[model samples]
Target: MGDMITTSEQQIPLAKRIRAHIELADPITWISPAMICICGALASGTATGFQWWNGAHWGLILLGALMTGPLGTGFSQSINDYYDREIDAINDPTRPIPAGLVSLNGARANWFFLGFATFLVSLIFKDAMITALAVFGIILSVLYSMPPIKFKKNYLLGPPAVGIGYVTVSWMVGHIIFAPITWQSITVAMINGGLTAGMLVLNDIKSVEGDRQHGLKSLAVAIGVQPALLVAYTIINLCEILFLVLAVMWGNYWVAAFIAFAVIAPIYSQIKLYNDASHKNFMRYLIATNPFVALIQIVSAFLVGGYFG
Candidate 1:
């Protein structure tokens, strides 16, 4: 809340500026794609391990990570930061753009370059599916961040849009690369999508004040934090419950038990989110806990594959 300048912001070297901009991309956010890779592999009904000595399969994984991380998620984060500069100025002034570490033009150029390079890389794969997914991601990133059609402004559409982009579509891209596309894969993707959307809602709680100031009606801003928290918990718990029930219906009682056990972490996260609505706390909790949550899905997929294989 205070406009105090940190020492890190004082040192304005070229490398530091570049790092600042890259940091804005938030590479740590790649858990979405990572989870997808795992789930897709499991749903593909194939063994998920690869030979580190084999360049072909390993290369595909690396390429997927590059596209999903820098080109896709990076572009989204950069453009979002650009569009949310005003809000950042209020809520997160030390961010790259708001802190004056990167020029607005420089940020725009980053988005353009990443967007093009992602598509170009996808084309190199000579796979229509990959190219389409890449394009879809780019389009979603633009629509989510750009004005007039910035879906991020609408509480109803914003979180779901991101959930679809970050979870379902991203997961499909990873899945299709190594696995046959199937109905089961899509079901997994949708479940992950719902979970991610709920997590996004909790993430938004931290920014309610800034969103309010920016006239953005995020769920937290529109319905109050307590009610928004309830909605988030509902979305998250509902998905997990469905996964558990389906696991039992499929006669995979071990998978159901695993998922039931994994549910505890999210409940703990919700309690933490309820207590500390600060952006810093939410981010810390999310980063620390989201992967574990994703792991439940990943391991559940592992069990599903084992049971059906």
Candidate 2:
């Protein structure tokens, strides 16, 4: 049986191998960071009065989106899967590694390739700040999953690491690609980071069983699920309220009104989840609420770019 399994692993066809590599990258998860990148670019461009129709402006936007979405995020997810293969065996045996679709060596090679590609692409912009941010993102990605500093093992560290990597860095990279970093952009990015951190806490709820089995101290495991849900709800609501305040302060009443209206459903979803606090309910909450979160980020970007610029 062992020999047959090894033989099948070794004989995976080239097309299937390629598909496994893409699965390791988890392209669906790339959309959020990519959309954030687009928001950043749009915000910066609007603020700076950049010619929207100009090819160069669009090119920069495209490059930024590619770097954050595919290369940077791909590296993060691949490394995470490699390190979490054992946990995945419990939580989701069908993942590329545990399912034997991708060999361990293949996963390592994919992450290294994506990380190197991210670095090389960052240099193409010829901006020192961009290069530095790329390097920071790469290091954070490595630390988030790798041993000795596996952030995912600590409830305090894991979610923030993901939030900073996914939201803060992506937003800053997009903004910096077009304009110098500004207080407004940084502030909004951090608020989004807080939002992401909150969402990540909820994300852990779905994997609580595997996480507890593996002794990984995820938020849901560290604290009871109900308490963790409250923490997540608090963090999320606070960030949204802060953003609404900022929109009002920036005199973007349209953005403020939009936030006020959009927050209603998510708040209700949070209440529903708080009542049940089960993994099944959490999944439903995510589906019901995440789109509104994305819309808030998009509108907030416009608010900062239009008013702060």
Highest TM-score among the candidates is held by which one?
Answer: 2
TM-score of each: 0.87, 0.94
Q: Against the true structure, candidate 2 has what lDDT?
A: 0.86
Residue lDDT tens for model 1, 1-309: 222234354468878977987877877776566556546555555465333355786677677767776678888888888888889999989888777787776777887887888898888668899899889988998899888889998888899988888878776776677765777668878888888898898888877889998888899899899899889888887888888887888788877787787676556656776787776667766775667667766765665455353
Alpha carbon lDDT of each predicted model: 0.76, 0.86
Q: Put down candidate 2 lDDT per residue, 1-309, tens digits, no spaces.
A: 021123355698889889989999999989999888877766675637334778988888889889999999999999999999989889999999888888887888999999999999999989999899889999999999998789899999999999999989999989888888788889999999999999999889889999999889998898888899989888887888899999888787777777777677677677888899776777788887788799899888877677444
> Candidate 1 at 275: error in angstroms?
6.0
Q: Each candidate's root-mean-square deviation in Å? A: 4.2, 2.4
What alpha-carbon RMSD in Å does predicted model 2 have with respect to the real structure?
A: 2.4
